[model samples]
Target: MRRAARARIDLNALRHNLSVARAAAPGSRVMAVIKADAYGHGMREAARALAGLSDAFAVSCVQEAAVLREAGITQPLVVLQGFKDDAELVEVVRLDAQTVLHEPGQLACLESSHLETPPAVWLKLDTGMHRLGFAPVEAAALVQRLRTGDLVAGHPGLMTHLACADEPARPESETQLRAFDEAVAGLPGEQSIANSAAVLRMPAAHRDWVRPGIMLYGASPLIGVSAESMGLRPVMTVGAPVVAVKPLRPGDAVGYGGTYVCERPRTLAIVAIGYGDGYPRHAPSGTPVLVRGHRCPLMGRVSMDMLGVDVTDVPDVRVGDMATLWGEGLPVDEIAEVAGTISYELLCSVGGRLQAEYVES
Candidate 1:
């Protein structure tokens, strides 16, 4: 069946983006983050595409790691959240996956686990991001314990999350980096503090391993900087066909609740994509969409399975013409701005119902 709406996953672009991350952090090992299904690009497929290039793969949990393992991915898998319980710890050990011990409870779980051979562990320090990890003061003690503990396979690496790396002007990243350095003073093992933004901007934070998430999927982590500016190529392009075209007279309202009223006679092309297909429902009129490779303004509310785009200025618009919601010519960030959201949400929210086609080149 020919699907009217589809998401094209460019594997080559994915590879290119990874290279960009690597280039930014030339000395650091790359842990390609494929969590949230590689931000909705399909987990196993992304793992396969990056298997040879990426030094390691990082996921949100052990289950995601198991998925990669089941798919025959041999690269080291790092569970960012670590094991939730003893059972998960066992599974982590069984799969030979590395786990991040973010809290005392996770450490306790690991200590109590009966697994004869525990997987390698990374100790997460709560430098400034209060969301996870042990306190900076507590990091040294935990590292000491992990070093002597039976559960850890080798010298555990140290890591921390950056709270404001995206905002380059902010001092929060520097604060976090200083705290991390102080916390891990005189400590053995590798260090990792740079995320996508830090990998690109903060050279001092680029430690032994750098975890690049959204950047690997071709989205910029920093504000005022574009992915293209960072030499990153978009990996996903959402395309749908125009299903119908209507010529509306002046004062004609379009879509539900008549939210958008046309002031001038215009040609509106109904596209076979909508909130149901992960297009943001809150996207306001004037959001940009590409019709016949020309920019067109989105009109009216995005419905469940269709959206209206003003294609009057776009020449040769017709039924079955391709309309790009985001990606390629149209940046997802622009659409996200119109939707009053972020590119992360838009990319991750790509609907499961949309057919995904993977391209190598």
Candidate 2:
């Protein structure tokens, strides 16, 4: 049996999320973002779970692509960050993975490399994000350069990430879309601009391939509608067992900072999970934690190895009672809100200290 803290992963939910992505962007191919260990849902398990469902898998580095290849995932894995050095190009090509070329430096490296054949590349255009990608004119020129000469092989596509697609009302999305459309208008093989947010909100941005990250794990990228409501199920459940229980008197300070002082006599259950275990230590007081299937409010500052939960309403909760930090009845977004972050951070930041159980479909 696993210890007090365990992370239960549901493979069925992963597949469901991919289907949701497909349904959202009916015309575009889906690229499942499995970077950061599938956003902390376990890369191999997530890849296995999403096998065949996702058109291609996307990761940040060549090493991640290699990991997927070693795990027998033969899908066309796209390296979003492209290669860091020329040496990584061989391994990337050997693994049959695609790379994203966003900067002049990467293209220069590719130009300088000696390969039997050039790998397929996805050209990222700087529509609006400004973080990574070539400007509109520069992007068009590069495509012409690659096509005119044999500097690169395989199909080259245009891809741009949305900056504010989460909020559909924002005019920036439309502006970016227009810019992207204009930039890749006549000089492209395919266009991919939609992320998880754009796929759900901006239908016009769904060009050739949609790269979805959080939505594949059933986390809501937008505020109003959740992935589950769109027929997606959560894949990760973070739970820990109560290790200690004690009665707290009124006015008793709880945990560090004395942030939460008991206003009434209440029974506190100390769960065996904390910052060290990847539970957000900055989570504010009154954060909801599931205890014995009941909603229990957190009492104080989260420690390095334990957090105090007020289980006063639960009549006879024990030290071995289970607490869900997020997942199942407790949504990751809700927990993220309390932690002053988003579900993406909460899910991906989950440390390797806890035991993980992979449930296959």
Candidate 3:
């Protein structure tokens, strides 16, 4: 634990975020999205922490779902991308996992295979994303096919991904919701249309199920909105200890490329975290890094194993002192904004090199 980068995961914060999701959609079942290694919080750890609170766990594929099952998680696992092939279909069936049939080929595969045990299914509609799922116009026919052909154990639940639910100003969320509603009119199955943004902002989109993803990790799903304003507590606090302190004279340079030239004498601290530990390489000068809870400006190019921070404003900076990269005093959103990316990318980009410390407080 000496002078190294560490990602401290607060389990209690995760529980609090789940409560926020629950309080927002009181009547809907919560399908906590834990894909991409639970957004780099460690999938097995996330599953263990959210097991009882989450109604079900949603992963990107059979492989991630398999990891959860191997970790002894008993909650219903939803394979969002569904199976990749016949072998995957068999594995999905074996895992007793719920699969989403989004394309005609997947539907055809299920119908023709005639496996001994059929998987519980959800029919995904494209609505407006135009990425995956069947067309909205074809929802009824597909649901009927799943029912009449005995391709699933029961009525297939209906789900659609929101193309622009995070952008509250956009008309796409409402349009997609309307399309989804029209597509499944009078269908007997449960419906899910609300992702994290929809869950908090558009209660109308909260149907029989609500899928909470980034918000579950205490990151804001909407643009320009702060997670702190939404009562979400950061679950992961990444900190790196100061390894060196250099006195900078006027015109002195720091980091790779010498992008930062000192205008005035300053105290610079080198922290033991950089792009190699998943810190954004492109995060420019002036990005906030918390030193003793005070904001410090990042100087020059981020290196592979270290970053330079201007800690002159803070008194008595020294080696072994920790600088918070994000979380706790800082929100991941702020870093993502300066890094020219989204919170999902920043969180998912966290590397395995850092020491992981789990905390409940």
Candidate achieving higher lDDT, 2 or 3: 3
lDDT of model 3, residue 180: 89
Clashing pairs in 2: none
C-alpha lDDT of all candidate models, in order: 0.90, 0.87, 0.92
lDDT of 2 by residue, 314-352 (tens): 988997878899998888988887788999888988767
Highest lDDT, which number? 3
TM-score for all predictions? 0.98, 0.97, 0.98
Query: Which stretches in model 1 have alpha-carbon errors above 4 Å?
Result: 1-3
How many clashing pairs per prediction, in order?
A: 0, 0, 0
1-361 per-residue lDDT for model 1 (tens digits): 3356999999999999999988889998999999999999999999999999999999998889888999999999999999888889889988999999887788877777677786899998888889998889887788778777566887899999999999989999899988989989999999988889999999999989999999988888998898898898889999999999989999999999999999999999999988888899999998999998888888889998999999888777889898899999888877787788989999998857788999998
TM-score of 2: 0.97
Ranking by lDDT: 3, 1, 2
Clashing pairs in 3: none
